[model samples]
Target: MGALAGLAPIFGAIGTGISVLGTIQAGREAKAQADYQAKVQEMQADEAQAASQRDAAATYRQGRLIASQQRAAVAGAGGDLTDPSVIDIMADTDFETDLAARTDIYRGEQQARGLNDAAVNSRISGKNAQKAAFISAAGNLFSGVSNMYSRFGAQAKTTATASGSTRPLYG
Candidate 1:
C-alpha cells in the first residue's frame, strides 16, 4: 500500500502526458485534413479555369467561322464587299467574339481567385485549431499537476494525524 501510494503522483503525471499527447495528435490530424481539403479546392479551381479558357477558344473559333461565312456569302452574291456597311459588320462580329472570349477568361480568373481565398481561410482555421489544442494541453497539464499535489497533501495530512503528530509525513 505504501509503495502504491508513493507511485500515485508518477502514474498521474504519466496519464496526463498521454492525454496531452493524444490531444496534440488530434490537432495535427485536423490540420492535415484541412490542408488536404485546401489542395483539393485549388485543384478544382485550376480545372475550372482551364475549362473556361477552352470554352472561350471554342467560342472565338465559332465566331470567326460565322464571320467568314457571312463575308463569303456577300461576295458570292455580288454584293458590295468593299462597302463601308459590309466592312463594319465584319468588324463588329470580330469585336463581339473577342469581347466574349475576354469575358470568359475574366470569369475563370475570378473563380480561381475565390478558391484561393477559401484555401487561405482553411489554412488559417487549421492553424487556429492547433493553437487551441496546445492551449488545452497546457491547461490539462496544469490541472493534473494541481490534482497530484492536492492528493499528496491530503495523504500527508492523513498520515500525520494517524501518527498523532503535527509534522508532515515527508518531513
Candidate 2:
C-alpha cells in the first residue's frame, strides 16, 4: 500500500514532463500547422489526464489486493482464526465459540505487543530523565564548590591580618 502510494508522485512528474514537451513542440510549429496544433494540444491534455487516472486506478487496485492478501494470511496463519480449516470445524462447532477463541488469541497478541512497546518506551524515558537529573546535580555541585573556594580565601585573609603577617596584596 505504501509503495503504491509513493508511485503517485512519480506518475505526476512523468505526466507534467510530457505536457511541457507537448506545449513546447506545439508552440514552435503552430504557424505551419495551425489546425493540427490545436488538436495536438487537446489530445496531449486528454492523454495525460487519462494516463494519470489509469495509473491511480492501478495503484488503488494493487493496494487493495495487497491488503486482502495480508488479511487472508492472518486468517490462515492461526488454526482457529475463521480460516478454511476452521470452517470445516465450525460446521459442527458453535459460531460464538470459534469467534471468541479467535478474538482472544488476537487480543493476546495485541496486548503482548503493547506491553513490549511500553517497556521499551519506559526504559528510554527513564534513561533520559536520569541523564537530565545528573546534569542538573553536577551543575549545582560545581557552583557549591566555587562558593566554598571563595569563602576559604576570605577566611585566610582575615587570619593573616589578625596574625600581623604581611602578605602581597597584588600577586
Candidate 3:
C-alpha cells in the first residue's frame, strides 16, 4: 500500500503528460486540415482563372469570324469597305467583341481573387487554431503540475507534523 501510494504521483504526472500530448496532437490535425482546405481553394482559383482565359480567347475568335463574314457579305454586294457607314459598323462590331472578351476576363479575375482571399483566410484560421491548441496544452500541463505539487506538498506537511519535526518545510 505504501509503495502504491508513492507511485500515485508518478502515475498522475504521466496522465497529465498524455493529456497534454493529446491536446497538441488535436491542434496539429486541425492545422493540417485547414492547410488542405486552403490548397483546394487555391487550386479552384487557378481553375477559375484558366477558364476565364479560355472564354476570352473564344470570344476573340468569334469576333474575328463575325468580322470576316461581314467583309465577305459586303464585298459580295459590291459595297465599298471604306465607306464611313460601313467603317462605323465594323468598328462597332470590333468594340463590342473586345468589350465582351474583356468582360469575361474581368469576371474570371474577380472570381479567382475571391477564391485566393478565401484560401488566405483559411490558412490564417488554421494557424490560429493551432496556436490556441498549443496554449491550451501548456495551460493543462501547468495546471496538472500545480495540482500534483499541492497534493504532495500537503501530504508531506502532514507527515512532517506527525514526526514532530520543528524545522520549516520551506526555508
Candidate 4:
C-alpha cells in the first residue's frame, strides 16, 4: 500500500508531463508568429519616428526660408511697403503636404501591423483552444479508466475475501 501510494505520484507526473508537452508543442507555432509580429511592429515604430523627426526638421528649415525671404523683400522695397508682399506660403504648404503624406503612410503601416498582431493572437488562441480540447478528451479517457479500476478493485476484494488473504489498502 505504501509503495502504491508512491507509484501514484510517479504516474501522475508522467500524465502531467504528457499534457503539458502537448500544449507546448501546439503553442510553438504561435510563439514564432508572435515573435515575427513583434519585430515588424518595432520596425514600423522606428520608421514612423524617423519620418516625424525628418518632417520636423524640414518644416523648421522652410519656416526660416520664408522668414528670410520676407526680410529681404522688406529691405528691397526701400521702405515704400505700399504694395502688399504676396508672401507665397508654398514652403509651408509643401511641408504640410509632406507631413500629411507621412502621416498617411504611417497609418497604413501601423494598420498592417495591427492586422498581423490580430492574426498571430488569433493563432495563439486557437492553440490554447486545441489544448483545452485535448485535455478534455484525456480527462474523459481517464474517467473511463477510473471506472474500470473501480470495478477491478471490487473484484480484487471479493477474491481476497474468498482466498483468506488480507486485502491491500490500495494498489
lDDT of each: 0.88, 0.52, 0.93, 0.61
User: After best superposition, candidate 1 residue 103: deviation in angstroms?
Assistant: 1.0
**Of 1 and 3, the candidate ranking higher by lDDT:** 3
User: Could you tell which candidate, 3 or 4, scores higher by TM-score?
Assistant: 3
Q: Model 1: which ten-residue window has the lowest total lDDT?
A: 156-165
Candidate 1 lDDT over 1-171, as tens digits, reads: 999988998999999999888888878888888898889889978987997899899989989898989889999999987899999999999999999998898888899889988988888888888888888888888888888877886766677655456887898
Please list the residue runs of candidate 2 whose C-alpha ends up more than 4 Å from where it truly belongs after superposition: 1-96, 154-171
Query: What's the lDDT for residue 111 in model 4?
Result: 59
Error of 1 at 65 (Å): 0.9
Each candidate structure's TM-score, on Cα atoms with residue i matched to residue i, is 0.85, 0.33, 0.86, 0.41
- By lDDT, the candidates rank as 3, 1, 4, 2
What are the per-residue Cα lDDT tens digits for candidate 3 across 42-83?
999999999999999999999999999999999999999999
lDDT (Cα, 0-100) at 105 in candidate 1:
89
Q: Which candidate ranks first by TM-score, i.e. highest?
A: 3
Across residues 63-137, which tens digit of lDDT does each residue of candidate 4 receive? Answer: 666656766776687743344433344444456656765675666566556655665675666566566656765
> Over the full model, what C-alpha lDDT does candidate 4 score relative to the true structure?
0.61
Give the runs in model 4 whose Cα sits over 4 Å from its true position: 1-23, 80-171
